[model samples]
Target: MAHTTKLNTDLTGKTALVTGGTKGIGKAIADELAAAGARVIISARNAPSAESTHHFIAADLTNAQQASSLARQINDEFGGIDMLINNVGGLTTPGGGYSALTDKHWEDELQLNLIAAIRLDREFIPVMTARRNAVIIHISSIAARQALWNLNLAYAVSKSALNSYSKALATELASKGVRVLTVSPGATKTPPMEKFIADYAAAQNIPEESALAQLLQQTGGIPMGRMAEPEEVASLVHYLVSPAASYLTGSIYAIDGGALPVVS
Candidate 1:
């Protein structure tokens, strides 16, 4: 008889920095990494409304000066981290397609969803290159592939750019003992998503449940029949960043519950 046991995902000596880690998928990822034994640090423009175990730093990543200051502060205080989760993106622009979107709207969307991560990576990758087995995870979205132009034109385009950037960065760093990967989650039940649904329902004068159904249908209907829990996405991220997934890199891992119709 052979004995079998669970693989250890312990990150006892590793340090992790999760951007926008105060809430939603970022919060879930931060919590999961901490549980896996990593010393976690979270950053956002504002402090969390609720108390948390992780150290919180205030920095608006959209600003280059603030981002540089944030990196310097972290390197000074914590000696730099082994893991970087670029999870500080959102749909901050309005809907109504390209006609309604201005140059500023597109620029703001890119700043939040794409450029912030790029700046942070530039600041951290030098230190990370000197370390052994460092990881960078970009929290992307399914909209990168199946974009809904009417509702998320600018945001989706930004994520598409992010996905491309992640792949390129991963390739460049593959020989440097650093891993870079992207996690694309669809229809996650986060606070912003819930609010989007609520607002949509009000706009259409329909019940919340009906609005949800319609929205899902527009996205080709999830085979799982519901939005993914934030922790579910976190679990996948935990695996990818763990030592158990040492060989994985330069890939976009989708956690979309079969919502994407095409096989890529």
Candidate 2:
């Protein structure tokens, strides 16, 4: 096995919690953090299977009550949350756009994408701040800025709000000792990507590969000519949580294969 590069930060005593961490980018993030030495906790509506060696908590974020309760549980059981990856979120309707989405659709997207992250931050980050050192990284997306997928406009919009929410939350927590950051990855080759491609293929009457091609084309050709694997995104999450990133906060770090056109 390849040696795990010793990261600058050794979370020897830290407890990390990753929301929606059962699979995909969230799972990857949790793994990376764990490998860096933090005891990782994966939370979702359903308990995350032990694909590796992390603890799992089942609590849905769509319900505000549940989000708060989960935070309390984290504090009680984990001895306070040192790191949190807010990763649960997605588009509610496959064909949703400006007119196709209803109020309920907006609510669901907002609840899952934006509110969930904020709820955790509001409920738990304060405890971390009191402890004097903690990290909170919200798993954001390129869709937050590009607004490229017409069919996923709602997803994009919800992420846009999450982007803003993360920044604002960071500013609020800056003086209090918590660091909130963002790691936005573009079309990663996760299980969700396969489903997204399959759905696009069926909806557009194209082959799955063609739908994948469409995704690349939409991103103006992922300069690297491939989607990122989950591990690559995980590496960034690992670094952000490590002491290597102590000075960082309120920044959106994009690992999008140079797909975003301009610098902000």
Instruction: Report the number of the highest-TM-score candidate.
Output: 1
Deviation in Å, model 2, residue 186 alpha carbon:
0.3
At residue 86, candidate 2 shows an lDDT of: 88
Candidate 2 local lDDT, residue 200: 86
In model 2, where do residues sit more than 4 Å from their true spots? Answer: 1-7, 49-51
Candidate 2 local lDDT, 1-264, one digit each (tens): 643444467788888889889988888888888887889888888765555578887888878888888888878887797888888886566564577778888888888888888888888866898887788999889888888546678788889888898899899889888899988899898877788889889989999999889877776778887889999999888888887777789999999888888777
Q: lDDT tens digits, residues 1-264, model 1?
A: 542323657888999999999999999999999999999999999999899999999999999999999999999999988999999999988788889999999999999999999999999999999886999999999999988978899999999999999999999999998999999999999999999989989989999999999889889999988799999999999998888788889999999999999888
The residue pairs in collision within model 2 are: none
lDDT measured at residue 169 in model 1 versus the true structure, 0 to 100: 100
RMSD of 1: 2.8
lDDT of 1: 0.94
- Residue 61 of model 1 has an lDDT of 98
